[model samples]
Target: MKISAAGPDVDMIRVDAERLHNMVSGHAFYSELPKDVRGKIGKRKAPHYLRSQEERNVASSINHDYYNSATMFLSQYVHTLPFALSQLSLTHAGDSGALQLVSMPLQYSMPFMAKAIAGIETLWPDMRLEMPEDVRNLADTWDLLAEQGVKGVGT
Candidate 1:
């Protein structure tokens, strides 16, 4: 969602269009596909949003870092059981330790969610949408909570 909102500023549509054309024209793998399929894929264009060249720059650099951090943490800690298990330090061999292990990662999602909400709030006008005042208030509340850190709150 955040990336799509940042697409216009980053020339993502143009890049993706070029990539699609290259897949059909430059790659032998796509050459093996049916002509109609290749043509359909090649002709497809990403939807555009109006923005001046001056306005388009690396406006989403921070979001990119957030995305990379989330991806790396999830891959190593949450997605794979063995990697997750290797990082665990359980003080007790009971349900409390097991629950604590699971909740730690889940609690880490608060900041990511807060960032997503902030991105949505920032992009709402460009999207021709009105974010309710209550949502903004809720996001502020979430941001405050996220700043307090995730330790000693669960399990």
Candidate 2:
């Protein structure tokens, strides 16, 4: 699938969100801390530490905020692939050329296709997207692509 930033013409870029997550999460600075220390420093689910009133002003001074930010940023980037593909499909009106948009969903993957469409709308202001009437069941779509020798995102 073609994707572009800041332009109407779609472009191909090798963006493996999993690899990006691995790179970020596997960093010694982020990963070497003891689990308890990590837990104490950052919320396990929320991606950021809770700052008390006294800490709020100084908290913003920390340089590692982006590290904390990456937790959710990378999570969303990794998890949003299928939804992105679906939205891209809609944007192209299910043009077969967009079929290359592929994603391997994680265990928590649910129907975020609508969020993806909204993201596309926000990202591409003038573009219009619509889901195709002939959209196949998820399994069938994968099977059909597999039969045609199309390697999926993970391969």
Candidate 3:
């Protein structure tokens, strides 16, 4: 992935997977886990372990150092694709052709958005998911219309 800026003041962007892994692994979020349990878990363990174990008990406790190290290594391998897709979506947000392609398929987009929201909730349960009041109003209106057997605008 590459990004170019308009001036000499803007340095070239570079992403080192190893460096990013090391940085993320060093963050307080990953570092604070108990070390003993991390060693027992396999490489294929779920990312929900990224969340603090204090929130919910796993069948076994994680080894903190192993969890952090393994998470760092795994994140290096796993995060690239989703990060690239997110960058692409942001880059294309203002392109009319791209917007039209995404917008023309509202049914598919709606479920995708819902799933993304659910994933966000799973990843950060304490975070609030906010939508504009107008969007909320529109959803309420659509639900009412659906209940009344009137498939009105944009349904």
Candidate 4:
């Protein structure tokens, strides 16, 4: 997914993909791959050495404009470098390498929650799921903050 800002090489990507496919085919699958080339990913489906095909078929089915932008905005930091690197905190300070604890700014949590709330609001319009007043109020506040570009909380 990361195609450095400069640009991505089409041939290199194709080659890399083909190599990866060969590797997976040669040593990854338990038996022959299923005829329906859809999915059954994650490490549980593979041996320890290979990578999991982390996917989201439902997310793929969504309107890309809204879902992708929001996901990409948050995805880079969850476990990725730079963002993860920024979370290091000194839990202990001593000559023998200080113990570090990963800590990130709490501000990131709200936007994800707000987006989730938006999803819930959309899906629960029929009122099958009763949303609490406080949660609704909080979502409203988040929406307002986003609208005003307060803390870059919204789209």
lDDT of 4 by residue, 1-155 (tens): 55554536776877896776567656645355553332433222434323222334133222333344445545666657575345434334553443323222234345445656677667887754665999778866655543333434444
Better of 1 and 4 by TM-score: 1
The per-residue C-alpha lDDT of model 3 at residue 28 equals 74
RMSD of each: 14.4, 20.4, 16.2, 15.7
Candidate 3 per-residue lDDT over residues 1-155, each given as its tens digit: 24554665444322354455556556675545555334322232425454464333222222334334434534543576674356456656568667654443353234334444555766898895676999766655533332232233365
Task: Summing lDDT over every window of 10 consecutive residues in candidate 1, give the lowest-scoring window.
Answer: 49-58
Q: For candidate 2, write residues 36-107 as lDDT tens digits.
A: 655644542323544442354234222233224334434554677664546554656466654433333321
Write out the backbone clash pairs for model 4.
none
Q: What is the C-alpha lDDT profile of model 1 across 6-37, one tens digit per residue?
A: 54547877688678677657776766765665
Sort every candidate by TM-score, greatest first: 1, 4, 3, 2
lDDT of 3: 0.46
Quote the positional error of residue 81 for candidate 4 in Å.
3.2
- Misplaced by over 4 Å in model 3 are 1-102, 137-155
Relative to the true structure, how large is the alpha-carbon lDDT of every model?
A: 0.56, 0.43, 0.46, 0.49
Q: How displaced is residue 128 in candidate 3, in Å?
A: 2.3
Clashing pairs in 1: none
